[model samples]
Structure formats: C-alpha cells, structure tokens
Target: MYRTWMRFLTPGPAHHRLGLVCLGVGLQHGALPTVGPRTLDHHVAVVISAGTGWYATPDGRRTPVTAPALLWLTPGVPHHYAPDPETGWDEAFVDFTGPATAPYTELGYIEPDRPVVPLTEAAAPRGVVARIARAARRDNPLLEVETAAAVHELLVTLRRARADLAPDGDPVLKALAHDACTPMTVADHAAKHGMTPAELRTAVRRGAGCSPKDYLLGIRLGRAKELLATTELPVAAVARRVGYDDPAYFSRLFTRRTGMPPVRFRAQQARAVPGGYGDRVPDPDDPPMIAGPRRP
Candidate 1:
C-alpha cells in the first residue's frame, strides 16, 4: 500500500536562529518514481527504515541505498533517488538549514561527498521524525520553534550515533552548551536528555570543567551584562530578560558573581566610554578601573 504524509512550513522571522530551522518533514511508503536528477536549494535528510533504493549525485555517481540508512541531499546538489519497485521503503525526512548548518558540516556530522549513512539503530531517528510530523500536524503557535528544536535534536542524535562508532567526545556536552539559555533547572535539563542530575553533573564537569548549574548561570549572567550595557532597561527588566524573577535576587547574584551590582557595572561601562556607552572610544588619559575579582 502506498502512503505518504508531508508538512511544509511557512517561512517566519521568529524561526530564524543560530541553530537550523525545520522547513519541512515527511514520511513516505511504497515505491516512487525517480525524483530529481535535479538540484535543490535546501537540505533534506531521508531515513530509510525498510526496503531498498538508489541515490544518484550530480557528478553521475549513483549509490545503492539499503534499509536502516540515511540519505543526505545537500543544497544546490543534483540528486535523485527512488524506492525499489518490489520492496518500497518506509522513509522519514526533515528539511532544514541555518547559520549553524555549516559548522555541522565542518564537524563531520554532515558530508556532501558521502550521501549514504548506515544506522546501527533506526528507532531513535524514526521517532524524532515522527515527533516532527505529529507536531507539524497540530499547527501550534510555537510550531516553528518546536520543529527547529527537533531538527537540532535530530542532528545531535545523528552526530552522537556516528561518534559512538568512532569514539569522539561526549555529545551531552554539546547538547548542554546549546541549551544553556533556556530557563530550566539542571535536573530538568538532565532529565530532558534522559540523565539523572548526578550523571549530568559528572558529564558536564568532565566535559566543561563546571557543574551544569554554574554553566547555565554563567550564560544568564553574560546575557544580563549585555542587556545592562546595551539597553537602558530597568534592573528588574534586565533581570527578567535573563531568566531571573526577582530583581533583588538577581542583583544579589550579580553582585556576588562580579563583585559589583548590575547598576554599578553599567555606570562604570558608561563612564569608561566618552559621550555614552555606545561610543567606541574610552577616554585616552583615563586610567582603566577594574572591578574586584569575580567570585569563585
């Protein structure tokens, strides 16, 4: 029986981020006619769970596709692939791209030269694609964000799986670093990745030389500093912007971490630059005023 489901996302500014945006997701079953032998403008990842197929590249290179494998169709690359007539494959796919995509390529997660990647286990990839498909069906207000996040997770999963075969560094570290801005507790963050708090802490410490809580706090505080330096927002507003609820607590934490309050830091920054904080030049003759050592 032939069956196919696809969801194409509308473009939106909010979906744009350092990480990839999921442009579309789909699932297909049964043999299909040859698609492409043409080029595309965006990337597509096809995970084949069953049956067999063949994919052809722009340079006239044809690759045999078997079950339990992934086929990557890179942007602007001429390609064509189709399922076997006798044994049509079950395929799940997601299309995505962003500023972060190139880094993945450089990191060897995605390769243009090699189109087919065999999967030791197909269930996880299939589940993620199913999640994207299901979420796309809901058409939620946060669909873009949700799908984008799923795409990121999918890529991380692929990379980690590949890494396991070759024995690279821990993937949890990368996941933690990517999710640092979200206002979740370390335990919650750990749980999201199926790790206990203790396990997460140990992994993070081994990978980043700090506890997960400290890592998240550092990200929040850095954002808080940027807001204080760049905007005229109230202290409370800045605190909220960086995930703090109580202004007083944020102030105390800021003071504890930096050895000066947010207000004082802003004032010092403003004074350091002539005219205003936006001005690039500091007073040439003015001695640099250093804040006290940061708390451990």
Candidate 2:
C-alpha cells in the first residue's frame, strides 16, 4: 500500500498567520511524505500547481483531485491526505492563522468539517501560485508576510466562489445573480430565463430555498455594503448602482438592509481590516462596479 503523507508548512521567523500558501514547483515536485496524520499547528493549504493528487479525510473518505483545486486546511483539524505519488502534486498552502481567519470562517468559506473546498470555475488561481512562487524564492520577513497575506486572499477567493454557487439554486436565483450590480428587474430576468414570474418564484423556492426577492436583496445588499465602505463614490452613486433611484430612498433601503447608514457602514469596514493589510485588499467599502452608468 502507498503510504499517505502529511507535509506540514514550517513558518520562518518572518512569517506569522496565514490563509494562503505560496511556494514554488521546486519543493512541490515530489510526493508529500508527511501529509497523513500530521499535526497542523496553524493551517496548511494545498494549492495544486502541476500534478494530480487525492485528498482524503479521516474515516477513510477520499477523492481524486488535480491542479486548480484549492485545498483549505484549518488549524487543529487532524486529517490524513496526500497526492497521487506517481505524478506527485505541486502546490502550496497554509493553516491561515490570523485575526482575519474568524471573519473568513463567518463568511462560510472554511468549514469545521472537511478542509478542502473548490473555487469558482470562472476564475483562475494562477495568482496564488505566483504568490507562492514569490514566497518560495526567499525566506525574508517581507516574503513571509506576503505569504500570509496571500493565503488570506486564497481564502477570500474561495469565499466569493461559494457565494456564486448556491446549494439550492433556481431560475430566479440564477437570473438575479446574472447581473447583481446592474438595474435588473425580476420580471425581465424571469422572462429572459424562460419562465413566468410565478414559475420563477416557485423554482427559486424549491431550488434555492429562499424567496426570489430576498435572494436578490441579499446579493444587492452585500454589493451595496461593499461599495459604500470601500469606494470614494458618494452614497448616492453607490445606491444608484445597486438598483435604487433616489438617494433618500437608497439610504432608507440601505439602512433597512444593513441596519446602518451607508456612511457608518464605510467607517465600520475601515476598522475591520487588519492593520497594514488595507493596501492588500480592495477597498471593502467601495461600491459595486458595473460597465455602465446608472439606468435611466
């Protein structure tokens, strides 16, 4: 029987906290020998660079995975897994321990159960691999910090993908997501997607398990909050982008949805980012961006 490996990441003095793994293909060519049953002090992620691997969990559950698969391993989760030794896996991942970790968890990216989760098919994780390569090139303090920040990003990417893939999705849900930042009407979306409004509502209920309006509102609210907090755009502009017309009405809707006015929302978002981490992430308070100006 092939022996399972549990390769744990060793953080240098320059490294602290993580959510990403940025290593080169050099140390990643060989089969990971220390993956199965190894202790995870922080969190170790496996980002496949150029090989096939099998990710298995405790209790004998296993699945074959390949490059492009993002493996999220939380700290303290004792699990046995490894790569397909023949081809061997090339990847880098970290336990991602930091203040932002909890917020990531709250966003439903990392789960308490299984560690690995796949990201959206539309986006490429090549940047993560590049970041890892950059880190592997050196062990300097700056590199260490960069690796940690990169891991956090990898987590965020997966979180965004999770939002995209709704478990119990339906036609209306899909339609609403089709253009979250644009001025879209549910009736138009329903017609475009080939269903009557009522039928769309029913499908949404059965497939996504949420009301169409609620689902759309949730997505819009998330976008609105992001824009209000991250961008220098005026509140009126942010509201306009998110489907509201009048700024006063927008403020009311924003308050109702987020329980705080747009201005306050922006302040809270600023306070939430980790010190020195602001430059890394897009302004969380920035508005939802679209290709066009507000609808007529």
Candidate closest to the true structure, highest lDDT: 1
Please, what are the lDDT tens digits per residue for candidate 1 over residues 54-88? 88777677788887888889988888888888878
lDDT digits (tens) for residues 136-227 of candidate 2: 45446566566666666666555445433553444456657867557767787678788898987777664444567777788888777766
- TM for every model, in the order presented, reads 0.56, 0.52
Q: How many residue pairs clash in each candidate?
A: 0, 28
Each candidate: RMSD to true structure?
16.0, 10.4
Q: What clash pairs does model 1 have?
A: none
Candidate 1: regions farther than 4 A off: 163-296
User: lDDT of each model, Cα atoms only?
Assistant: 0.79, 0.61
